[model samples]
Target: MKPAKDWHAAPLPADEAKRLRQLRSLALLDTPQEEVFDRVTRVAAELLQAPIALVSLVDEHRQWFKSRVGLDVCETARDVSFCAHAVHSESLLLVEDAHADARFAGNPLVTGAPHIRFYAGVPLRSSGGLVLGTLCAIDTRPRKLTPAKQAALCDLAATVEREIVQREAARETLEVQEVERRKLRVSESRFHTIFQRTPTGKAIVGLDGRFVEVNPKLCEITGYSADELMHMTFQEITVGADLPADLELVAELLDGRRTTYSFEKRYRRRDGGTVWIDLSVALIHDDEGKPMHFVSTMQDISGRKHSEEVLRGYRQELERRVLERTRELTSSRTALQTITDNLPVLIAHVDADLRYRFNNQVYRDVFGVEPSSLHGTTVRETIGAAAFEHCLPYFARVLAGERVAHEGIVYEGAPNRMWNATYVPEFQRGEVAGFYIMSQDITETKQRENQMRSEVMLDALTGLPNRRALAEQLALSIDAARDAEVPFALFFMDLDGFKNVNDQHGHDAGDALLRQVAARLKKTTRADDLVCRLAGDEFVLLARGITSTSACSRIAQDICRAIARPFEVGQSEARLGTSVGIAMCAGGTQTSAEAILAEADRAMYEAKRKGRNGFRFASLLAEVAPAINNLVDRGSATRH
Candidate 1:
């Protein structure tokens, strides 16, 4: 058994003991071998003209050799080793002969191993005067060390101390690095969790345009599997025509010129369709401050793009029509004649007797007469009395010197198509000369106008009826409900936790999620049901003819589940749960449409307060309840 550690083996000051502990904590007392130490020991041995030189670490009960130039063993017991006592000395410990030295005369190592005869060692001390170990040179022959040789030996030991400090510093740095690596690993796991499951597309792109990392949403949006997208360039999935001229922006980022860029661009969907995406890109720089690569977020904007296109078309059409009308009104008579003759507008003249006089080719052809025959013919003579009866009042007003202008009526003598006509009484010297008729073939125009009016009532983003159209539908529905004495439910729904996606991802992703929510609502509701968008994430559903509160509640649950389904947008999967408000008409109660809509909206807010992703049916019960019951019931039934 080794003797108990001698805490008071020597008289040492408090500061010196503290520093000695620090030096010991460096863990160099018993260490492995290395070339820097070996070289030092080798040089020390050669300079001292000794057979052996050692860099030794002294522990409590043993001395461990870090490097021994002429010795084969790595360590020895403290009872036999000279370095064990050398560590206690502040300076060199010289033993001229271990045989004569009482401390080693009975040591088994000195008698058996390469016998250490002449020994000199210097303490390896820290800056604070803590002796950790020794660097000693050994010789086989008994000899005394010279003063200069002793000094050189001390310097060499000091060099060893410096090496120990450098090693300790390097070890501490390695430990710190290991701790940082562990933290980075945990952070990377968290990042993966967010990247793989987030609701928006995310990617790390190389300077060469290759994707270093891509989220699942990106895989879904591009129609390629996640494995496939990872090996591809961003350009591979990008539609070439839609690629921006500033693709060099990525290069600039790599060259340290820019930090971030965002743009609207198109990507080729897996199904070979084009999907519009708004991309936000940021450059990642290395430690040297050179841009290494880029990280980007992609959001789907196909619906918004479609809405923008429709709005642009409407604006352009309005502008074009305004310009065309301006030109027609400002041009000369010859130009007018040319336009009227070539265009679908019908133009002609009638005399005070309602006779077809000056007429364009269309008028001549419609009247089935030459200009000579129709010039002086009366309406009764040219078109027959039946046609004459339709326009006699207008002609009488013109003949009485009153100018007439109206739409929705036209009269042609021979072959007249259904036309919308405007009649103006031409004046001559302050008296009515004859009627100048301008008619247009507006059959296609009327059809298109009606179509546009219907479309304007629908939400372009969701394909649901918009608020304007909902008002009309509600009014009509209310009338039918009143007549039949039947009650209907009005449900207002708002998605839960939807704002976070907008904040973290972007507006484009938010819009896409809204569209998906709209689709889910449509799918969950009955086909006959009318769902309307009240703008900005608000929806109103009229369960056109519901039976009871329970029935309406069932529909609301369905909606909640439908919305809760993962929304795979771009490169991310997001869950936008719903909070629904339900208000059922009292089956026969007389209430305004506005009142019902407001009640539904209020209830929806109540649902939001009771924790989102839930439903609140309008009072009999105003108190909030745990939504778990409803979710469980819904889950069981809908699972099939």
Candidate 2:
């Protein structure tokens, strides 16, 4: 054995501190003996017929044996270890005779018992480029190791490295899984609470439509006990007119053609009265994606339905009095017709069959038809197919004793006009007999509203999406990416030397340059990619479905090159470059839009720091040093 004094006097490698950290990260030092490591050492010793073999991890003060054969001691002083020198080399270190070597001539290990003579060790390097220790073979007799033996030792060391890396990876995977499991447990707990307390009539129904489970609200809505509802199928309670449609939707769900559906339907309560409900139903699936059951939420809308009926009745009574007065003043028909013909709004009455029973002169003027010709014509024939389809659903609701009002476009004249149309049901003997239609032009109002909305969402100078629009789109993109599990990259770009343009060439010229830059960015990116003017001299690009960092870098490069081209502003040409920072989220990573934007912003500044006109990916900065270095070198070359 070597003297303890000499062991403390041995010089440490330059990377000794870093290597010790890497060794500790493996967590193999002073660990219990593992059969896997022991097997490797045993095989290595048998191959070389060495008296001793060890898998040694060099720590700050000691060389610890993770696995050893023909060795009673667990550790030795680091300075006295042959493996210490091996850890400093990238390849195998061999000594045919330690006694003859100058470094070991006065060493106690060579001069004392268990005399060291021959030694061969291969450095075990970590993925981070730090050599943690060595896989070594030792012998008391002075003998040289052949080329084959040296190669074998290196191979064994590589195996040891692989084992350590694999173990670390396995541990990390287990930790991630544990975190996920805990989150799932919390989510399930919250879901259970909401499912039990939600006020909506929630129920779980079997594929056959029989109630498998029902909440308290469902029982109250249906006026049935839980036991009563469980014994009945959903089709049994549904109104006859709505049953067929509901059954078709349920069939679609079972066949996997649709996962969820919503519709307005009527159901018969236990008391034999009809209740209107807005029903939303979804199918739950098993692990294999087989349909398991239907989850349904029903909200009662009977009060709203009743209010509509009451409003329809009052309107119908008013229409009846007006018709009676018109009949009574028939003797003054010419005066009445003259007054109505001069009015701007269109007025008409349609019977339950949708046939026009009456129409004023203004209605004829709007449709470009004679007043007499439209009296007996159906609305569909008078308005054309597209408009008829648009009005049909509201008409049906009107005929169902509901007052309906909606806005629509009419394209009959030289210019298209928008109209606010109201349909009031004419009730007779507690049923809808006909309906009166009133339409008022609102084209200018609609146009102004649309213009205001556009102004709010668009950048006034560049005509690109403004910050508000970018935020909205970014939110949508994040949701879509999460749902589809697709990767996307967000780039935060700032224009370099833009302030100089404003200083040298006036603000108008600066604005012009910005508009040109926006156009260039739009032209250089894909149609689906969103490029927005975030603020003055700043823009953002959201690139979807990126395959890799290389692709994202290419996009940034394209933008840089496009913006670098000279811009013509009135009498002068302006030049500016773009610096970009990219933040990426792969599929299934839960990251917010704001988080990604912040990350990209930080990276953008990093690019600017490394001399502008380049892009840097946030993830690669810490994990891939070589790639980052290469990017910097390439960027410098491009600048030159």
> Which predicted model would earn the best TM-score?
2
Q: Write the residue-wise lDDT of candidate 1 on 27-47 in tens digits.
A: 765567878888889888998
Candidate 2: list runs displaced more than 4 Å: 1-336, 409-415, 483-489, 504-509, 526-529, 543-551, 568-574, 584-590, 620-640
Which lDDT value does model 1 have at 287?
A: 55
C-alpha RMSD values across all candidates: 28.7, 14.7
TM-score against native, each model = 0.35, 0.46
Clash count, one per candidate: 4, 0
List of clashing residue pairs for candidate 1: 217-570, 217-571, 217-572, 218-571
Worst 10 residues of 1 by lDDT: 4-13
Prediction 1 global C-alpha lDDT: 0.71
